[model samples]
Target: MKTDLKLNVLSVGNTSTGSRSLPSQFAEPIRPDLVKRAVEAIQGNTRQQHGSKKEAGQRHSAKLSRRRRDYKTSYGHGISRVPRKILTKRGTHFSWVGAVAPGCVGGRRAHPPKPIKIWAKKINDTERRKAIRSALAATLVKTLVAQRGHHVPPQYPFLLENKFEAIAKTRDVIEALEKLGFNDELNRSSEKILHAGRARRRGRGTRRKKGPLFVVSNTCSLIHAVQNIPGVDVVPVHQLNVSLLAPGAHIGRLTLFTEGAIERLEKEKLFMQEYKNLHPPVPPAPQSPASHSKLQNPSNTQKQSQPTQQKTQQPSALQPQKKVSPTKAPSTKSKPASQMTLTQLTK
Candidate 1:
């Protein structure tokens, strides 16, 4: 069965060229549970393992014995039976301070983090793939995109022509986005706020809102051009994951897709290979009688299409062809075949 969803294909000028059917993955149900699990797994893998050293805060020479008459004993002392370090003392009488305990100063932590602790959360391969599809589907929902706090164009799931990948200039990319009705979104993402509390002190000093994500079929100059733009990200279709699509376990992100990316997604059967095997893509509809006639009468159609076909039929005169010339062999001595050029060997 054909999907009811049809995304408008936008030209380089931000004009709608036509429409294309979305991939089956975009039709998957939004499963927030799977999305959150997948995102947590991804984030978990990136967590840096950290822990206090084994000797940290426990290197002091402090020692105390509760046994009566033992050396450095605290017996008969008013203080509790805790380890104590000597400060200053008189003969047979000592002034001690608690040490090597959680309540004491410069003491080891009660429950310090351990390096051996496993930080990564495990997820099934199928569940991770499903989460990616769910997140991808969420991007197409206007309400979900809005709920995620993204300022989006009126048309959700923005689709751009394949030509959009060739964009090499940041200014041109910005202009195209503005024309596509994302001026407000661009402005919104541009605003940066200082991170609150310790996070600011630690490396993440500022944070910016995530803007529209551009998903293309392959790497291109556009990736470099958009890197400097605040909050804007360019990712290849194959590299798409749940974390990028649904940051903080929240579904829905403003996403822009190139026509080539859509084609790749379907052809590769990404994230929905199992479902695609059950239902193959529908074949193109039969051409109309009038359209069939136009196809049959190629002579008439060729005359009308001559101008567009000329570039392919003839090579450009501006590009000069290179010429190869025969070379004369040296009379002194014959060189090895490997050392001689083809032209020199011919002589």
Candidate 2:
């Protein structure tokens, strides 16, 4: 648990509202193996099942006999004892030709498919949840997001305010993202990729890039606003899975979360089944019980030790000169006390 890990919260206008500590959901270790497994399972479950017709070619008569005294027998004939249809017959004599069998006309299939076959794959609930956490953690890393071909600003890993969920117009959303320096990312995700294969014949060969994902606490108008944007997806925070978090089993999907969504994830323990006990929620602060790791303080209340610098300037009388120091600027780093203003028991 990175109790000191704080991220700046940016509004839709690209201005920082305040800093917030990341939830325990992002504290998980990156386990690519589990992520890949979960993605494969999801892919398997989504596969459309199909097979050949049940009774493709079984509508012909091809019965034959090897008896010498029978009416339609192949006895005393030079042909082998194979199933066939009788073309013409005489008393104790028969003329026949092969039919109604594999390699013959109108014969049943050698091996046909059945609809009963299952195409879905199984994954344990525990492993699935762990994979989700791992993927979630990967999203906060700047290098991974950049390596995945996403255009990230300097403040790549920032949280979103609840105000972002209220935008209901695509034009306004694009305008807000532009203000945040995401024009390049939007263009990158808007391009169409054409693949050359039989899938093209089905009119589905063209695909768009997978871009930013918006996770909200509740269903809002933002879902409808970003629906038509190429490669962008809006999903409820509770519905997060390996597929959305890490598309095609690849890590580092650029994600945006509303402040309410972050609180909900922590308060409800959304994707932390295995590690839920590891970082048990501390006693809720008297001001707010809706907050989880964000609103709590460290157990040890000892003050942080500050480093002091000793002056080594030689103010000797030889030159009778005193060196002047430039004015120092205040530190921009946010402290735990400053972060308390973000979700202070009120929106």
Candidate 3:
């Protein structure tokens, strides 16, 4: 008789068992009702923390005022005087204190101050603990034995692998995990986890000494796309912090799938960057005539052409001056001859 007994080989926060396969115990039949109940129980057990008391209610209070008139009447003429029927009238035995109105000095208070309303919602201890455990158990059971291209039983289901860790900022960590066959199909929301938290001192500088961590999100974006094997967390490894990576912080053991995915992502990223650097964008061939002109007429070319133009202008000006001087010489000679002829005629 082939009997199916459940085995617990994978321990959370423990070292890798180095075994590639499940211990055959997780292959037992699944109970959908049990899983549903577990999900409900886990959800019901979640605890939401409350804010500060001062922030819970409005601080400034509204002010209120009150005034009242006395019913008893006092009699008076143009001159001050007490009426005969007044409480303080002559021969009246009533006390003056009793006749005083409420809210007056030594009188009873009309309205006392009121307290403002304040309330808060809180979670119970038992429910919170139960929820955490149930969620973990559910994740563990589904990830261990499920297979790709096969119907995943609730007790032993596998998830398909695709772009589960695509959104991680650290490509190195994400690609490393993808190379390992440990992704699972859990229908929940997915998210990219960032690295932030307390640091622990290692040998030299401060480091996240808590070992490693895996983050499973409640996002459904990559749930069914990846081979739903149970071990891959879509989150990057470098983003985790010491507090989150501490012993007992995560739900299961840290596997090489995560490490391998990160490595692959790093390599791919490097290769892409190298390819981009090696094949830089070629500048567009100078299309504008203005740019071409600027390049061809560099400083030396401009200086050479300017000197030649100046030399041509200088020769032209000199030739015109030389022709004008010769014509002026002939005019001077003709003027002297005309003056001599006039002198001889007068003699």
Q: Best candidate, lDDT-wise? A: 1
**Tens-digit lDDT track of model 2 for 57-80:** 654466766777786666777877
> Model 1, 1-347: lDDT tens per residue?
22678989989787889999987788889899999999999999999999999888788888778888887788887788777888888886888887888889998899999999999999998898899989988988899999889877776666899988999999999999988888989999999899788997799989888998999998999999999999999999988898789888999889889999999888878777463453578999999998899899988767654445444545569978667688977688768899999899888
Clash pairs, candidate 2, are: none
lDDT (Cα, tens digit) per residue for candidate 3, span 33-145: 33344444434345344443432222222111122232332222122222122224244232232212232333333443223322332344333323333333333443431
Query: Model 2, poorest ten-residue lDDT window?
Result: 293-302
RMSD, candidate 2, Å = 33.9
Two-way lDDT contest, 2 vs 3, winner: 2
Best by TM-score: 1
Return whichever of 1 and 2 wins on TM-score: 1
Model 3 is weakest, by summed lDDT over 10 consecutive residues, at: 59-68
TM-score (all chains, Cα) for each model: 0.75, 0.65, 0.20
Model 3: number of clashes? Answer: 33
Predicted structure 2, TM vs. truth? 0.65
Q: Give all candidates' CA lDDT scores.
A: 0.87, 0.84, 0.32
Preferred candidate (lDDT higher): 1 or 2: 1
Candidate 1 at 113: error in angstroms?
0.7
lDDT winner between 1 and 3, please give it.
Answer: 1
